[model samples]
Target: MYKSNAFCRKILCGVAFAATVFSTPTFAANDYPNKPIRILVGASAGGGTDILARALAEKFSQALKQTVVVENRPGASQTIAADNTARANPDGYTLLAATNTNQAIAPHILKLSYDPLKDINAVGLIAKVPHVLVVGKNSPYKSVQDVVNAMKADPGKLTYGSSGIGSTQHIAGEAFNLATGAKATHVPYKGSSQAHADIISGEVSMMFDTTSSAMSQIRGGTLRPLAVLSPERSPELPDVPTLAESGIKGADMYTWYGLFVTGGTDPKIVELLNKTLNDALATPDIQQRLKSLGGEITPMSAADLAKLNKEEFERFGKLAKEANLQAQ
Candidate 1:
């Protein structure tokens, strides 16, 4: 009896030791982001992605007790920054301020230096911004149906510009084509700002762009809103009808913002990022700032993001093939 009790005590001690060994990393995350955290933005500054990246970085900095630096590596449908993050150290210092364009859409289209799903671990979703299909204020097409009619009438004459090829806006436009059975030739630009610029100057007829980038222009009479792609009209633009209301359905097509890091980063690190980001997202300043930009903050766990990413990739992949979109 004495020997059995001693063995039981030893076994309990060993189990406790094993538990501590496995659990220490999680308890250690409170000390994470001790160094300056690099938040990679896949687009140039001043665009929606950049704006949100900076906004969240500022909030994360204050909360995490570390400087959250926003780095721009814009190129190739914003895959440059995605690839950079994929290849970055797994130490939690480098993270991608990812968007649907770079995280979900571009991976399906752009031949990149890294793998979106395999090379990166999603931290969490930052926010969601609805898109507006807008045209020049002077354009004759006033509504979504009118644009579709014109496309059907001429097939490829009316052109729409995007931030770049394989971007969310680009794929959103193609998805619109898939829904409406009206194909529009896609013209790519360096960024949404330039795409909006071209639309303003009538260099491009229209674009499916983030509401934040096109809202002021639409309100100021520079661009005309054809439709809001949300299931309902946006609070900022309550007058615009949804694409579903205009005859397109089955695609929500909203622009999503997320944070990610190179895969193989400790799961503890990923959860730490999720906690920091979700906590920051719940704050009033970040919430209001993102809201004012027409973005809705959504804090999801890494596992949730992983599952959601697979769904989005499947969704866009199907649409891309259906639209015969050439992936590079």
Candidate 2:
């Protein structure tokens, strides 16, 4: 009788432990997002990144039944905001709205406090906006070939403006130089607005600005887009040609945005976040807004985003070396 009681007790304890272990994840997922969630943007308010974040926050709030907020931390090539997110508690309450500048380019050119791949896990990709080669309306250069010829004629005379050092714009400019074998000076500005200002005033020769950022100027006839630095032509500007078509190869670039949470976050939470994000992207309102911003939405799973993050990191490392980009 004593042996029988002991065996029964052991079986009950084992069953209880197994149940607890199996049910924990479900509880965590169901109880998740009971509090407000905040997404950190590495750019200032009203910028493309911030705008995207805000738009998603509204959708996230609606889907999750929780208040979602966007916080701007805009500096250090977006590393500041990235680091903050990396250091936040892995509770799914904090997220980073990251761009290629911080995820791929800045890390190659700056000494960061956090490891982009290890310290933060990518939740999913949001959208990508291609860069367009633009010059002031009054500029003499009218085409990609014209810019290439002028740069070849005066190796260091032609100048291209970028948002900042190690920015996608800067790397795009360098990539153009590498592909075309033409040298042009780089003028780094504090932000794209400043770069646009200089380009409009003819202080800078040209700029590889994102279509979203330069759309207003392009439509206002203050800026003339020469070609898109993308694999294909932009739907927003169907008339514009791609750099490849214009004889410039190996210079395709885009400013891609994605969501990331601190490393070691619960996989269930990450899965939920990815699902929520994809749902938001699928909405008609989101699709229309992103389309208006010259963005392309391609929903990707968490694993897919992780793979892309790794590939972009490796690709940028090689490109930076070939372009002789140095950490500042």
Candidate 3:
């Protein structure tokens, strides 16, 4: 009887241990996101990146049934925010609204504290927006070809403004120069608003601005859409031709946004986040809202986004080397 009692106690203990071992992951998965989630953005309020972050945050909150907040760090060309997210706890509570400017371009041109490709795991691609080549309404140039011609006619005389030295706009301008042999002087601004102000005031010649950022000015008639820096024309500016259409091949530039967490995040958590984000993006409301902002909802799997992140990282590294781009 004593031996039987001892055996029964051991069996009970073993069963309990096995139950915990099997149930922990399931419990964690279901109980995740019990707290608020924060998404870090590296741009000031009212900027294109900030706008996208906020919009997504709201949808994420709705889908996850928890509060989603966007915290703006707004400096260091977005590396500040990227680094913060990279160092955050490897839980699903913290995320970063990763952009090509921070993930791809800044790594190439800036001295980063963390590796964009290795330090973070991409949850999924959120959206992509094409850059629009625009000039002041009263400017003499009418099209991308016109600007290129001016640059060729008097190299280094024409000037272009960008959000910063290593921004997507800067890359577009430099890529344009490489493709069309135009030498336009570059002027970096603290933000796109300042750049747009200079362009409107005629202090700068042109800018390769995001469609969403340039939308107000374009509608206000302060900026004229010359050609989109995309392979295809934007629906928002149907009249504007593509750079390729203007004979500038291989100059297509689009800023892509992704969701990310620290690299060591559990695969199950990453899968859940990807599913939630992709589902939110698929909703009609999210689709319409992003479309209105000149963004194409291109929801991709986490694996695909990881592949893209690495490719862009390598591609921009090569570009930076060829252009001799240095951290400022």
Candidate 1: what lDDT?
0.82
Pairs that collide, model 2 = none
What do the candidate models score in CA lDDT, each in turn? 0.82, 0.89, 0.86
lDDT, candidate 1, at 22: 77
Per-prediction TM-score to the true structure, in the order listed? 0.86, 0.86, 0.87
RMSD of each: 5.4, 4.0, 4.2
After aligning candidate 2 to the native by TM-score, how far in Å is the CA of 213 from where it should be? 2.8
Local accuracy of candidate 3 as per-residue lDDT tens digits, 142-245 = 88778988999999999998877678888988888899987998887756777888898898999988886788789889999989988888998898899888
lDDT, residue 86, model 3: 86
- Pick the lDDT winner: 2
| Candidate 1 lDDT, 58-168, residue by residue in tens | 878887888888988777888888888888877788888877777677766677778788998888988889998999877888788788888999898888888788887
lDDT string for model 2 (180-205, tens) is 99999998765676677788899999
RMSD of 2: 4.0
* Least well predicted 10-residue stretch by lDDT in candidate 2: 188-197
User: Comparing candidate 1 with candidate 3, which one achieves the higher TM-score?
Assistant: 3
Error of 2 at 315 (Å): 1.2
Question: Which residue pairs in candidate 1 have backbone atoms (N, alpha carbon, C) closer than 3 angstroms, thus clashing?
Answer: 111-328
